[model samples]
Target chain A: MDLYSKEVMKHFRKPQNVGKIKNADGIGKVGNLRCGDIMYLYIKVAKDKKGKEIINDIKFETYGCTVAIANTSLLTTMVKGKTIEEAMKIKKDDLVKKFGGVPFIKIHCSLLAVDALAEAIYDYFKKIGRPISKELEERHEAAEKIGEELKKHHGGLFKVEEELHKEYEK
Target chain B: MQKRIYPHTTTRTENQRYFNRERRFLFGVGVYLDYAATTPVDPRVLKRMMPYFSKKFGNTMSLHSFGQEAKADLEESREEVANFIGAKLEEIIFTGSATESNNLALKGIALARRSSSGGGRHIVISQIEHPCIMESAKWLESQGFEITRMAVDKFGRINPEDINKAIKKETILVSIIHASNEIGTIQPIVEIGKICKEKGVYFHTDSSQSLGKIPIDVNLMNIDLLTASSHKMYGPKGAGLLYIRKGTKIEPILHGGGQESGLRSSTVNVAAILGFAEACRISKKEIKKEAERLQKLRDKLIRGILTRVPNSHLNGHPKMRLPNNANFWFEFIEGESIIIQLDLLGVAGSTGSACSSIKLEPSHVLLAIGLKHEQAHGSLRLSLGKWTTEKEINYVLKVLPGIIKNLRKISPFKA
Candidate 1:
């Protein structure tokens, strides 16, 4: 059975923002080989007219199924031109709603896209030394623990918290 | 191997040149390459089945003329299937499905023999029997029986010597699959059968995947029991058969109104059985020429994908595989992703790996062949059928290379 909506298929057929952005401000690399899904989400942050930091550009490279890739593609469109706090407000439910619906089995795909975006935002905060909210910090910590565990399977391809940080610094 | 950093140069093959994000993917008519899962019923079989459903439907054991007619046709159908497999009319027992047939074969013998004084309490099966057999063996173990799961080589082919060594004085039965459902590796059942015969153990091969595809002579091959499915061979779904060689001591798993010599005791679905018989009839007539046709097409697909796409490898016994099956796995990508992209382009295929399963595990069959978890996850099974045309194959060849290239781009792993 088709696990994605017509809208999801539309984006997945021609997923926008699929390539990597070099020297990006914040990059979120999440997922593991065990689940056979991973995403490299790149974001270029800029200030809008209100002098608030906004997602000027976003793109993703995801190793996943229909919903995972489609949601990642749709996610780029959802957060572009939105302020960091506003983009962070976007949740997995919002992505699912925007794409019509992702099956219950594939809810994790949308969750992964949400996690990738959140991780990118956290990375941006860390890169610029901005004060982070306690909730965001907790979620990031939890994601790191899961990512760290998943990393044991394939440490090379699945870049986790510390390794991803090291890569960005280099 | 070190992971290549981002912005690493990827040598684009000729196929990748066709990947234009701007040019819309040409959605062709749905091309089915997953015939192993199930086949649409043949029209001839359906026509033969129609009368049995409404007109000649009756319980085989009833005293009335309606019952007599159904009973006559049932035996005729049984004889036809029995003749196809070179087994006697009395040896064939009809069941609901292949799963049921396999369960009956494993558990029936285990139960019937456990009570006898000299009957052995050990069963030997291959490492890669269908889940039905595996679960039955596990259940038998819980009932205080010993099970020997013999291993297969890298190509998923079992060595007869290993089976010969694994059998014990207490071994009563040995079950192995004729051909693998996932990788299409055909086992050497004839030699295994001889070894079992020499050792005084019954040999049962699950021929659900190979029954109509390959010729079987149970007597010549020394097979004591065999299982065959209908839906897999362009017949109805509700019928399956177990060939219990005459004089084999096996008890019925399902006890109801005494049917089929009281082996499988249920009012038989007359229509499905007739349809299955007709399917066997047609398959017997066309098996030789069709096998040749499918073999050529299968090889074309295998060669096309391996050459067109880089970092792709074939699965299963490359030389000893089934005529219609071609299984492959590409590096640095998941099978579900490939299936979705193929589905969008109007092609149907299956993956050995099931990421969405509750356990989140790849196919055990692929893992048994010594593939890594990620390698197993990337495996795809493309099986051809009578309806598969050259045009459909050409369409797949045109699209598959690009699909692999596209998914590999997003895949984090490097070749």
Candidate 2:
């Protein structure tokens, strides 16, 4: 039950760029406190040479265990220099690779970070009045499904909407 | 208290130096606040048992002088445990563990009742009982004996009224934990035992957490069967006891040489039993003073955590908890994170949520007390012990707030 890798401890000990981004172009949040993990991904979007949006700045705030916080920290660092499409390409496995590997029980933390990143990119697209693509919509749905599955498995006490509202107040 | 904040932007070296400086103040004791998990064997108890391991070792059942000597010491050890709980010499049956004792109590009673009497094959137990009791109940259910799990209140107290209602014509026994190891809530066993007595049903209590820490009188509580563990009370781990009142019929769970009056069959663990008796004697002798000292520390810890860490709360009953136990829920931060961070800071503790279990369920005790699954996952249990010093408590109180604040800063959820 050594659930944490050395990388997880390292990132958690020195997590980079924590806290919310003010007036960020896109913000995505996932997880509930009752479920033992909550991740918020904030991205500042900028355009490169061919008008492709790049994730110029990224940050995250999380409340979770070592893997959850580490994956979020690593997620921010992994996606900061990538294009919005590239950031969306970051999957659960990529974060697991960065952590060496997480225990099976903690795979959900990596999934949460990937979900938040996808949702943040979705926010960026919606803000620019672009029609959401089918793949992006499916990724968002799948990510939402992970949260739902977690709640069903873990037996959450607060409704998702209510939990999200409480986080906003904080 | 002035709010002390460490900026998140501080260098790793600065944080390390700060923790090292705090650690140096504590003289390398490495604060052991997880006493509820298990305790180091007291030196006195170990010294008393060392002779039994090699010097005077002999089979208690053998028909020889060597055996007679061992038998004498075994009976003496049993008498010590019996006197500690105000039970008769024949009442205590030594077993391997509290888990084993619980199994014997529940299953043994259930089987005996089913075979001998046509009355009831049902049993009653509180939801807050340890997993051993719950798992034993589940096994009994599979064996065709109905089990009624009584619910506890928000403070983890099982209502006697609920117990009275739950008892039925077919009910054979009722088992409750005298004190919860997780949350430290003390049940009103005397009142429950009285109700059981009026109904003529047997009452069993798992007093593993309360026996050495608090006073127990089987006569006053009307407890017919009780389970106690030695490891929890600063003795060796391999020894436990099940106290069966006279005339209580329980079928033998293990069949062999018929040791322990045919209830538990195994060659007695002489060394461990001797150590257990020594632990019981010491606990009985010093219980009052130790209890008072721990209560002061527990109260100090509860108040410090609650006031210094905003959104933190004490779990279980405010006044009815164990003298050495303090459990708290720190909102918006996971319990595992708190425990791990505290460990890194030289403080050892436990989370109500068990990460190593298959299902990873939050503490059943916390869930039984009406905590949301999220809140349950954020709970911490810090148990004081005989060796816990005021300086260790002070160091923890000072350092823990900073850890919580840092964790909250990175947490996406806020309370």
Candidate 3:
């Protein structure tokens, strides 16, 4: 399948915010080593004058296919200036739509971006000892489960998507 | 031939500017380094095949003068191909493709032995064989034959002793690739063949990639059955040869018309066979000198890439490999990205990742050779051919390091 969309290709050719954020507030890493795709998301959370937490700066480092790299690039662009709450609401579908659309086979890549964002936000909340909501808690758990699943299938027989699908179904 | 032209609406200056912009977007003169995949038919072979299309077109089975002429050409071509491989003329059986020839060898031998009084039910093949052989082994498994896939070393070279250990009292045949298309590692066919011979089991080698690039004497190698594809050695596609030793008994895969001495039933593609014979003749004459030239180029490419690119490695055996092939694994960046970037520079090559499948999987060959999934996914195969020039190699050397650096810049792997 033509897994990479033209928009994805554009982002891949010129990815933005593709490094670590020093002394970052939160870090989220997701991937299957067997699938040869890994993405590390770094976010620097800042409290504005209103005392609202915002993702002031975000960066990513990815080793994967065109779709995986592009999704990370798009996710970073998406959450850079948004409040932590707003970033939590950014769904995988939104990421796919922002990049025109990815191939059906590559929807998991968009999900990876969402998972990284959720995990990062969860990390931020834990660091500050803030009360995490039920929704945020659920997202964090799902992202954590994905991380565990990826590690479990480090040298898996099934494809990455199949393993992830089974985990989501569970 | 018909000549055609399109009406142009742009002025000369506009046309020039447009072409310049287009050229900037496009890669340089298309450099094809995927010869292990296939190659363009040699013009000389094409020239010899022209008359057979219409002028001398006849069914070899017919009794007319036209049939006699076609028959004469077919026999002569068979003799040429046989001479090229040091086999007798009658030992060659023409098939549609290399894949077909492999099926005929593997299935044909297995089935033939199944019906025999003393024939066994076990077969042995290397883990790094082409898909055709692998699939054939799978089929044999369903047909109640015991199949053992021998493991290879890190260099993708299978040990002859491994074959010896894998062989059993019921082992009927052993088939392995003469040279690997992905990693370019040449198997120890002579030693393995001797093993199979000593064990009283038939030996088959798929020489689709190695036939013309290296020397092969079927009798000397003790190869009972050998497969060769025409297109891999500058011959036309749609024609391949299976060399069945004169006394080897094998069942026919196809069942009609009684062509190819009833071993293969379809009417022969006369023109394609002629082209294949011409290719074989030329390859036999040019192989030694050509191997020397391509070996120098292959070494230069391997050395340049390994030395220039950090964390880069050679995939196959260092010295005992095909003279035309050089495969590598670059750390950090995946192979698909490298291929796409190389395509932009007009360099055509291949990767070990089976990304084209329904599920993205690294090459089984690479995995069998002990490369981690991540390393296997980042593999590249640059296979040179007769048309590959030193200038093209230099161009690749000039542009490749820059592409690797750019890809590594965006990679998540720190190394």
lDDT of each: 0.84, 0.85, 0.84
What is the Cα-based TM-score of model 3? 0.86
Q: How high is the lDDT of residue A152 in model 1?
A: 65
Q: Is 1 or 2 the stronger prediction by TM-score?
A: 1
Report the lDDT of model 2 for residue B366.
89
RMSD values, in order shown: 9.3, 7.5, 8.2
Query: What is the overall TM-score of model 1 with all chains considered together?
Result: 0.90
Return the TM-score for each candidate structure: 0.90, 0.88, 0.86
TM-score sort, best first: 1, 2, 3
Alpha-carbon lDDT of model 2: 0.85
Better of 2 and 3 by DockQ: 2
Model 2 Cα lDDT, one tens digit per residue, B1-415: 1111134427667755654554445336689899899988876798899988787889999999888899999999999999999999999999999999999999999888888847588899999999999999998899888999999989999889999999989989999999999999999999999999999999999999999999999999999999999999989999999999999978989999999999989998988999999999999988988888899889999999898989899999999999999999987778888887887787889987644234666888888998877787788899998777677889999999999989887875542
lDDT of 3 by residue, A70-133 (tens): 8999889888888888888889999889888876867887888888887787888899898998
- Show where candidate 2 strays beyond 4 Å: A1-3, A32-35, A49-52, A129-135, A145-170, B1-28, B64-67, B354-358
lDDT of 1 by residue, B1-415 (tens): 1111112336444223332211123223578898899987876799899988788988888999999999999999998999899999999999989999999999999998988888899999988888899899999999999999988888999999999999999999999999998899999999999999999899999999998787888998899999999999999999999999988999989998888889898888889999999999888888887788788889989998889989899999987888889999887778987888898788889987656455567787888888877677788899988677667888999999999988877654541
